[model samples]
Target: MDGDDRAGGLTRRRRWPWVVLVLAVVVAVVVAVLFLANDREPEAAPQPADPEVVTLPVPTPTIDPIDVEPGTRFFESLPRTVLEYALTESTADQAAVASGAVEAYRLVLGDGGTTEVVVLASQWRDADAAGAAFDELLAAEAAAAGIPVDQVGTPTGSADDAAAGEQTQDPAAPTEEPTEPAAPTEPTLEQGPVEVDGTQVGRYLLVTRPDGSGTVHWTNGTALLRLDGPATAVRDVYAAFPL
Candidate 1:
């Protein structure tokens, strides 16, 4: 379900901003054409002028995953935590955010190593819900791994601060970056990864390296989650949920 936001006497869809921008572009092109025609120099009254026509491109908004399929089973079965994070977290990448669903799996063969994969779906009630669900899923995934949930959750703010720093301190800027009113804000919820069973869950791959190991994070409006190590196994599992 698309979440509803209302105030005063006016009611508008949550997705209206992108729509309005596209329309503005269309209006501009139309006005430009009219003005050009009005200023055309007048020719001799008796001479018939050849007709000239111009075509302008109209703006088209990109479609979200939710628009193509709303409330599909792919979205319904998604773990709540994953859903929460996708809707809330601002750091989600565009490809993941655009995807309407998420899928990830690891094959724990009797062998020593693990095979894994993860995918996110892009369909949801709204941004708020998507963010909340994504964070929750990350917590659950981390818990499945040996990592302490606190480590995952505790990093939320610091990660956000780091992200904000990157957004503001663009290298292209000549002087110190000035903060603007429209600058991206930090996440609303406190979050971190979880310990899955006793193992430290890597959203993509759990590593035992000289440095450190962790999962990969991916998210979208309707889907968000982490995958620990390798992608093959998780990718296979994700395929089943597409119906």
Candidate 2:
């Protein structure tokens, strides 16, 4: 029995060396696989970059700096006159345009009391110039402005003296009595209040005859342009005019 035990022990010892050799081979194979995996390149998926955005500047609106009011522009279109009168802020009211109108027109004047037109104005050199201009525009070549006659006054005198002078004249006589013609009626002006730099500088309304029609009229500047309708019509004359 002892000899058999010793033979079994020898066989076990020989198998132990082969097991150690097999373990060493398995460890070497594992290390080689790990090194190869580390050295190999990794796969990557490409992603697109975010797009860029562009911005533009917005445009701004434009505005007119001038007074540009219809009435203001009406006066402004005329020849240069007193700055105050030219620059004066005026209301554009509806006016009546007589059928008799032309390129050079005379506006039928308006009365402040009864008519819708303005019978008074400023900046003309004189009444003669104003009337002359009106007449020229009406029946002549110059631009016509409206002129209005306001009130017809009664002359102060004795009717008896006129009757006695008439009675003395002989009806049978061929010669007629010479008499001096009465003076032409002049417009009596009523002034408006003028303000200069916040102080009073009394301004006044100018009076003129309206034309063939006995009426009154008013305006601001010289070299008149007679538009024959209402204030809106005056504004309608130009589309660019600012009302």
Candidate 3:
């Protein structure tokens, strides 16, 4: 029995090379199968990006920075001498575009009650300039309304005039100057243009007439130039502002 076992061990040693070759062939076959299974069509090419949209800015006359509540006594009780009104903020921090330190404006005309003439702006030098522009605009619009610019009663120098004229029994009465310094008053919004800092981006809706359409313009914090005419109709003239 011992001799027979010895012969079997010798025979198995001689066949080892054949066994290794068979194992190698089996591995190769499996790898080929896997490779074929994983083979697939090439991926499609990436699509190109779309072109950017371009829009041109439209300009118009500037207005005061103030919010107007519709159908209110403030709207109905507007002075006849006042064509429009606004209460612009001294600083953009208190304005709609305060986040950008940009100037803003709103207008309310004297129709049956108050018709918002035009309100759009979002860039300026400072709030004081905005207030100044409001005064100027009020004066201009009043002049257009056949009232003398001097009699527009701009709330200049002191802010108390805003309260004096606003809460007074007479909206047409001249505002008395304040005797003592008071805390800065919130801007009073009347329908008209508001001033801005020397360095401001102003766009406006320049209404030629209450019945007729108006033009729009842009300002480099200086001159007001017409950027759009009757052919260019826009809902919000300031929508075309780049700022």
Measured over all alpha carbons after superposition, the RMSD of each candidate to the real structure, in angstroms, is 31.5, 32.5, 21.2
Which 10-residue window in model 3 sums to the lowest lDDT? 223-232
lDDT per residue (tens digit) for residues 2-50 in model 2: 9989999999999999999999999999999999999888867688788
- On the 0 to 100 scale, the lDDT of residue 240 in model 1 is 26
Q: Tell me the tens digit of each residue's lDDT in model 1 across 143-208.
A: 554456556434335777888988888688778666765532322112333234665332222222
Compare the candidates by TM-score and give the number of the best one: 1
Q: Ten residues in a row with the worst lDDT in model 1?
A: 82-91
Q: In model 1, where do residues sit more than 4 Å from their true spots? A: 1-118, 153-215, 221-243
Please identify model 2 stretches exceeding 4 Å from their true place: 44-48, 52-243
lDDT of 3 by residue, 54-160 (tens): 88553222454344444433223322222222333222124434533343433332223333333333344564554455445555556655655553334455677
Q: Backbone clashes in each candidate structure, one number apiece?
A: 68, 25, 30
* CA error at residue 113 for candidate 1, angstroms: 19
TM-score of every prediction relative to native: 0.23, 0.21, 0.22
